[model samples]
Structure formats: C-alpha cells, structure tokens
Target: MEASPQYTLTERGPLRAALKTARPQEWVKNVLVFAGVIFSGQLDDTWAIGQALITFACFCAISSAGYFINDLNDVELDRQHPKKRFRPIAAGQLPISAAWVISAVLAVGAIAV
Candidate 1:
C-alpha cells in the first residue's frame, strides 16, 4: 500500500502564514466596487465615494473569508498537488483551527461593516 505523504510544519510565523492564507493580492479585484460610483459620475460626491470605499472594504473581507474557507476545505487535496502544496494550510504553516476562527471573524466583520 502507498503511504500518505508526510507534511512538515514550515518555519513561517502564524501572522505571516495567516496573511498568506488571506490572499491580499486577490483583494484588488474588490476595487471594482468603485466602478459604479465612477461610471455614474459621482466621484465628486463624498457620500458616494465613502460608500464605495466601504463596499470595497467589505468585499475584500468577505472574499478573504471565502479564501480561508476554501483553503481549509481543500487542504488535503492541495497537499497532493505540486503547486498547491505550497499553500499555507496545505504546507502546515497555518493551523486549521486558526483558519476557521479567522474565516468566521472576517465573514462577521464584513457583514457588520
């Protein structure tokens, strides 16, 4: 029988691991929320600009939450993949329990925003 591959914990700190898991680079996509205000020519409206910024922030949080959840779910599978094996969860840099907690906090915070 083939044995399961052993995974060793990486030396990366928890905060760095967590940030990598959150995938901030993906957050840039959330900036599209401002398109509505820009397209409507409301750039001069402080309230509209404020709302757009808030929406963008909320989307960023929610998207990061989704990423955490996805990584948690796919961790085992990711560990088997050549490229995905480097992911924080897959590589054991971020604890599954901590990922769950971070996901929950981000999701709730986004909703509260």
Candidate 2:
C-alpha cells in the first residue's frame, strides 16, 4: 500500500495558522486595484492585468507576512490584551519561531517580485 502523507500535529497547526492570518476574505479589497486599471481602459491590456495581478498578490502576501511578524514580536503583549489574547501566537496555538520563518520567506518572495 502507498504511504499516507506525513505531517506532524505541530506542522499542521502552523500551516493552518498561516492560512488564517492571510485573511482570504480581505482579498476582495484587491479587486479595487484591478477595477482602477479597468475603469481607466487599461483592461484591454494584458501586460497591465498581469502586472496588477502580481502586485496585488505580492502585497496581500506581504501584508499577511507582516501580520505574522507582528504577532511574533508582540506575543507577550498580545496575551495581555483582551482580544489579542486569542491570537494564534499569543494563545500558544502556533509557535513564534514558525511564524518568523514563514514571515521571512514571504518577505523575500515580495522583495524578489
């Protein structure tokens, strides 16, 4: 029989936490950037659409990466705050080191773009 995919419980928490921090719901805000280009009659231009898409994606990832970094840096303080205490890092649901690693990788990806 083929082996099942391997992933530790610790690994799953970080992956899930990272996705949560990315806030997919807020990606709708990025449509505004495309709308601006389209309203300007730039929609017919493929290069414009492609570039805008890349920028939009990069910025979204960067925003999430920044959030992760902030969480790691403020974990202690967040634990003291009423609402923030429920955050992944602050709640100890996600490791601070893992958050930093994800943030660093995202930051580099954005810079290269």
Candidate 3:
C-alpha cells in the first residue's frame, strides 16, 4: 500500500501556488459567474462567446499564477511530502524562486486583462 505525497501549509508564501493547486474550486466559482449568461440562451452571440472565452482565459492565467506561487512557497515541504515529493519544484525539476516570479507576472497580466 502507498500514499501520495502532499504539500504542507507553510506560514509564508506569495499566495499563488495554493490557489493553483485548488484551481478546480475556483473554476467552479467561475461557472457560477458565467451561469447568468449561459442558461439565458444568449450563447449564440459572437460577442458574448468572446467575452466568455476571455473570462475563461483570465481564470486560467490566474490559476497558473497561483500554482507557481504555491510551488515556490511549498518547495521545502513539498520535497518532503510523499506525493508532492515528485512535484517539479520539490523534485528539483523546477526552481522555487523562478516559480514565484512567473506567478507574480502571470497574476499581474491576468488582472490587467
């Protein structure tokens, strides 16, 4: 039998990675945001579709940013985690500091759009 490695909650962070890891939940919230327009049967409008796509894209960016930030902050704990031990940063396949910077940049870009 085996258990997957997992990340530990650290006291310090850039706050993005945690968000990314929990992106599915945030995505659910997005669904709620878009619900108003979907069942309204306005899905045929090109402009509406475009706006929805944009919204989805923005959320994707935000999710990515959160992932990076979480990876950066959890590097140490991740390395020690059973499942998380194999994560890019935890496994030394990625750089913690770099993840942080990338997340920050992505977050700003998402917000700007």
Candidate 4:
C-alpha cells in the first residue's frame, strides 16, 4: 500500500488551506441570523444579541461543514477543472479523509451549539 502525498508549509501551509476551506468570505451571510432580533426590536437586549451571535457562529460552522463535504464530493471532478483544481483538497493541500473528520466535527459543533 502506498502512502498519500503530504503538503508542507513550503508547498502549502495546512493552516492556510484549512482557513481557505472554511470559506470565510461567505461568513457574511451569517449576518442574516441577527435579522430576527434586529427587526423585532430586540437589538437593544443583551440576551438577544448574545443568542444571535451564538446562532451566527453555529450557522457559520455548519456552512463551513457543508463546504468541506462539497469539496470532498467534488475533489476528483475539481482536479479536472483548471480553476477548481487549485482548491485545497483537489490541489492535495488538504486531505480528503481529514476533510471528512473536519466536516463531522463542525456538524457536531453546530448541533451542540
């Protein structure tokens, strides 16, 4: 059995790749979680703000998990595409098995929260 290739910081730092996997730019959509409190006139309440923040964080985690799963499912297909081939998983910057673990962890975190 052969071992899979590993990516080092020189090639592509795992941390950077993981962060990219999370798709931080899309986190802006989580802001909608606060809309309920904001439009309902509960924005001034500390408890409501706290809840909304928690909800936003959970949603972010869930969304990231979704991205991980999507990437895992598309890794091979992505490798065939010029642009998508550069993605962390398809580029071999991140491992597919690790992505599965991360996706499960994020999903559990979202559910627990």
Kindly list the per-residue Cα lDDT of model 2 for residues 41-86, writing each as its tens digit: 9978999999899989887878778888888888889999999998
Per-candidate RMSD, Å: 7.8, 4.2, 9.8, 4.2
Q: Which consecutive 10 residues in model 2 have the weakest lDDT in total? A: 5-14
Q: Write the per-residue lDDT of candidate 1 for residues 7-103, one digit (tens) a residue.
A: 4335467778898888999988888999999999999999999999999889988999999999999998999999999998999978999999999
How well does candidate 4 score on lDDT at residue 87? 96
> Can you write out model 3's per-residue Cα lDDT over 46-68, one digit (the tens) per residue?
78777887787788778778777
Error of 2 at 99 (Å): 0.3
Error in Å for residue 17 of model 3: 14
Q: Candidates' lDDT values, in order?
A: 0.91, 0.79, 0.68, 0.91
* Cα-based RMSD of candidate 2: 4.2
**Which has the higher TM-score value, candidate number 2 or candidate number 3?**
2
Regions more than 4 Å wrong, model 4:
1-11
TM agreement with the true structure for every prediction: 0.85, 0.79, 0.67, 0.87
Ranking by lDDT: 4, 1, 2, 3
Model 3: lDDT of residue 110: 89
Candidate with more favorable, higher lDDT: 1 or 2? 1
Runs in model 2 with CA error above 4 Å? Answer: 1-12
User: Model 4 Cα RMSD, Å?
Assistant: 4.2
Clashing pairs in 1: none
